[model samples]
Target: MHRPACSSYLHQLRRRLLLLVLLSAISAAQGHADEFIYNSFSGADLSMDNQASVIDGLLRLSEGTDTKGHAFHTFPLDFSNNPIISSNTSSVPSFSTTFVFAIISDYDDLSTDGLAFVLSSTNKLFSSSAAQYLGLLNSETMGNESNHLLAIELDTIKNQEFGDIDSNHIGIDMNSLISNASKGAGYYTPDGEFKNLKLNSGEPMQVWVDYDSERTILNVTMAPLPSTKPNRPLLSIPYDLSSVLPNTRAYVGFSAAAGGIPTMHCILGWSFMNGEAAALNYSDLPLKSIQQLRAGRHTYKTIIIVCAVLLPTLGIAMIVSATIVKVRMMNRLSKSRTTDIEWEREYGPPSFTYKDLLAATSGFNDKMLLGRGGFGSVFRGVLHHSKQTVAIKRVSPESKQGMKEFMAEILILGHLRHRNLVQLIGYCRHKQQLLLVYDYMPNGSLDSYLHTQDHSTTNICWAQRFCIIKGIASGLFYLHEDWEQVVIHRDIKTSNVLLDGEMNARLGDFGLARSHDHGADAHTTRVAGTWGYIAPELARLGKATKATDVFAFGVLTMEVACGRRPIWVDGANGEPVALSDWVLAAWRGGSITDAVDTRLDDYVEEDIELVLKLGLLCSHPSPNARPCMRRVMQYLRSDAPLPADLQPDNLLRIGVSQELRMMSVERPMSCPATTITDLSKGR
Candidate 1:
């Protein structure tokens, strides 16, 4: 009997699984960390053909050394390989990410090390970190044995000898130590060498984790070290990412819950296959169950045949659907608000003839280049239209988010026309030609004055600085309060804030910013934005709100007052007194003079206190406690005594300030040793 395609497919899948088992057995001769699926966080295939399994994990997106630190999110991969961070996609879909999670750490206590994979059906963001899961529970120290979080405990050393699990074990948690979801199933997971893993060595390890949105299951595997091969399997667990998907976006990454028994685990790298490659439903399927596979050969053959057909059919369906989805997604690119210009209608960004920009930028030459970001380069160009000089942001389109972000920038910026926001002049809407045009800022960005640029602003005296700060405040106020549609400037770093010839601060780079409103900040899923300037709330809760932006302003205001970047601080040469901490301390000591820009030493004590107070109030520990932009202006313009009690100590206590030494994102940045594929090769 030919039987239906469904039965045939099930048989095929079973056969494939059996084949894999046999192949794995034959290759058992190899060792761990041998088969590497190189993931550099560049926009590419998540699987990399590595065939790694996932338990509970997400991808490692490189944030590229923001002012403070960086991390990435794991998500249901989109049709275009971009993780689906928004819920605004096709509903007729099954979401699954390949590879589970294993957080690597050399620390003895698991609670001391922190990590989590946030799930949100609403907010398309994921958040995670190694040392401490910052502010997750709000009222408890890390590893305090009581919190509302899930932890993948990779305790290298035994702290809880009386637990039902082993030292190097895996278990499900609900954010606290007292209530473990794992039954008697926890045990010491042995690596290929059968040696105990040490998370305190400051060494890195490779872990595989996967999530199925349809079935709500998670699977995991781990190697003692990064890229372990030849059966590097350590532990595996079935989980449901959708269980918490309501709380976060589809992007995935590491997250940790800390309590009394601190431990450490780090996710060295990660990836998730685009929209539902194949999910095995163990509850319903006989083939997925190991018991069924180990059954009689006749049954096994039937199941294998079914699986082979099912898997191939599923793959083909996914490919076709994903292609159609991509075409549809690319078809309705956001229309330019003002379409009277024929140039935009005919040739949009990434498609606009590069030759035009080449002539404008003088052929991508260094002199015309404006600057570089985590994605690609920017240039200064003059459009023959109106013969006006404008800035061109030329992205590599290879960075994980290049294409989508380029489109987003074009869409949102094209519609926005605020004096404080950079205006989008035009875009090149081609697949290979990634470029954007904006009104040029001859003074460069705020960073040029604070750092990077060798020349200080000859025009920016104390009054100018105050004006600049107020200008930035105005722009921020527009973004947060005034705009009809509230926009969160996710990355509010100095580098992102531009300056006109008059030194007026204008917010640039809407690439990371998102539209958010009240009551939406508490459950953020995809945690993004520049580090350092990112609010403490973002670190604890992935949500970005007006208050979150306010927190960043606090960090930014500190920079403005000191004329320095947030990365540099007053102390922490040895002690914990960072710039923010010291500011509070100084305020408390009644010597608010210490928070002034050393250049402003000549200024009166009261003026310094005004700026210092503003910075401190913005940096308040509680988001609710933070004053709004309107109130902030009232305080800045009028001498409101700075809050002596405003809390800046929390960030320090949570170890967020000591991020470099703990997380140390300053490792040498790796780039393609050389660029081989030059689009300008034709030239």
Candidate 2:
């Protein structure tokens, strides 16, 4: 009887121990379900779109120029409840995420837009754009509260429109590209010292982001890879995510974009949890994968070097002899043929053979022609070697004036690089035909969208128009003040502003652009440019200056805002009404916003008023009264307030009244006699 009781007690104790072990295992499983760790994305479950790919176990967000990429977690996380929060507290869950990323670019000091860690309601961002938009939002959706988005951006480009602090920065974005709070990419040490880190250094770096629900605080920390997290966070802000994330479920992801620069954004490791994220092991990351990718580039460089050194000496001698023989034959044929070699040596841009250009353009077929202008016809071409689409402008062989314009474009655009400026790739000359190649703009000219009567093309919204206005201003600012020399864009109009694939404005047509040393007098004496865009001083003095460029920009601004050309015949009276005069009249009548593009039904009233008033100020008859491009940028960005004395009466007192009165009857007295007609046609 005593032995039976002892056995029964032992059985009861074993049953209780087994039940406790089962409970512990269940709790562990629940914890794992709420978190994830990806040492490498080789087999990780991720939703990718566009250019995003998993290459060599690395999660590459973007791989090439003018592309956007997105990668998101396969499952959504519930943010409605927090384990650490009390019943009366907010429902938004506290979370932490850590990731190691790298930005590799072909250039050492330059890169396109950067990447962002995003928490969005949906994983599909198909409508997002590349470049400064960063694949998170487009011009239409940016800054809208309905987005319900939260992002931490590591931006490598400084966009003034978004109020970026610098090129290398980490910002907290709430439903917009404009950051709520931003800091230079850096961290403070334990001893209260700050150190800067370059985001596009082509090296791996780690970032940590944590949110505390109780305190409603967000902390972001970063450090170079393989280093311990700094004690102090780089950016700490007191904000509630509950407002930005209205939905209970959110998908975490990464979005990146590249502009004209070739860049690669990659992520090596990632960890995220509802609470504190698990620490990532540096050694476990797939560092060797990206290393090998970089090594491949190095191998290509080595091959190029070896080829340069190992060229057969005998072969080189034979080639030199053949070149001498060919030159002798050409000399015997005609001395005039030697001018081609001299022209190539003087203008130091890459030269393409005539045969290659002919092949690229399919022998200049009519179907390949993009548009015809006064100077030349532009043809769309695909280069055989690179498979790159380019615009080839073939100058008219018989037109003596076309040669001057061709040389001007080559001398100016070949040496310039800016986001808003069309890039000149190379030049070619065969017989009497002059060829100039430029990066292709797919969306065509801004004039087509603004003034086209074709129902097929969609009307540009007010947001896109505003963006184009700012883009043109930024490019003009770069030309007038930022560049080494002062460049006066003699022709600044809707037709000259080309829209790229993303509809970003690129000021092209530099045939009339004149550059001079800073603070030196302009030597250009010819009064050139379209009729309405020509400045008053330019017509009288036959000189181009930065102020003249501003005047034309002002006219273009009002034209864009009002959705009318600078000069259009009034329907009622059949008399020509200048765009500037009409806008000024609207301002005087206390209905300036009414002059805005009628096609646009939705827009910020204040922005419309600001643009109209700024246009008038810039178009003032006296060049001295006009603000510089720098001040214009500040006014557009609202960094500085418009002048208190700026009014229609004040402008009238400054002689604009007389000028407009003169210009009201079809053509003004100051209009240049040699103004280019049909300037609105595509170039």
lDDT of 2 by residue, 463-542 (tens): 89889999999999989887767888898989889999999999998988889999898888877777667777776677
Worst 10 residues of 2 by lDDT: 674-683
What's the TM for model 2? 0.65
Candidate 1 error regions (>4 Å): 1-353, 452-459, 517-523, 569-577, 601-604, 639-683
lDDT per residue as tens, model 1, 1-683: 65788898999999999999988977763321112232333342333111122222323211111100123342232223223434643321234333323332212122232333433222211232222232133223334432224444443322221132433444444444322433221213334245544433334443444444444445444444323332433443545443433333233333343222222233334434334323222232111222221233236445545554464455555657577666454333312222312333323313235677778888888998777766789899886533568898888857768766776676555545455678666666444557887889999877667653543443356776677777777777766766545777776767778888778778888886676554454334666765556566566556778888887788777777776555443343533234566576666666766666665534556666677667767766678878888778777777454456644444234444654344334532122221212211110
Give all candidates' CA lDDT scores.
0.50, 0.82
**What's the TM-score of every candidate structure?**
0.44, 0.65
The segments of candidate 2 whose C-alpha lies over 4 angstroms from its true place after superposition are 1-27, 298-302, 305-314, 317-370, 378-488, 497-545, 554-625, 629-683
Could you list the CA RMSD of all candidates, in the order they appear?
Answer: 25.0, 9.1
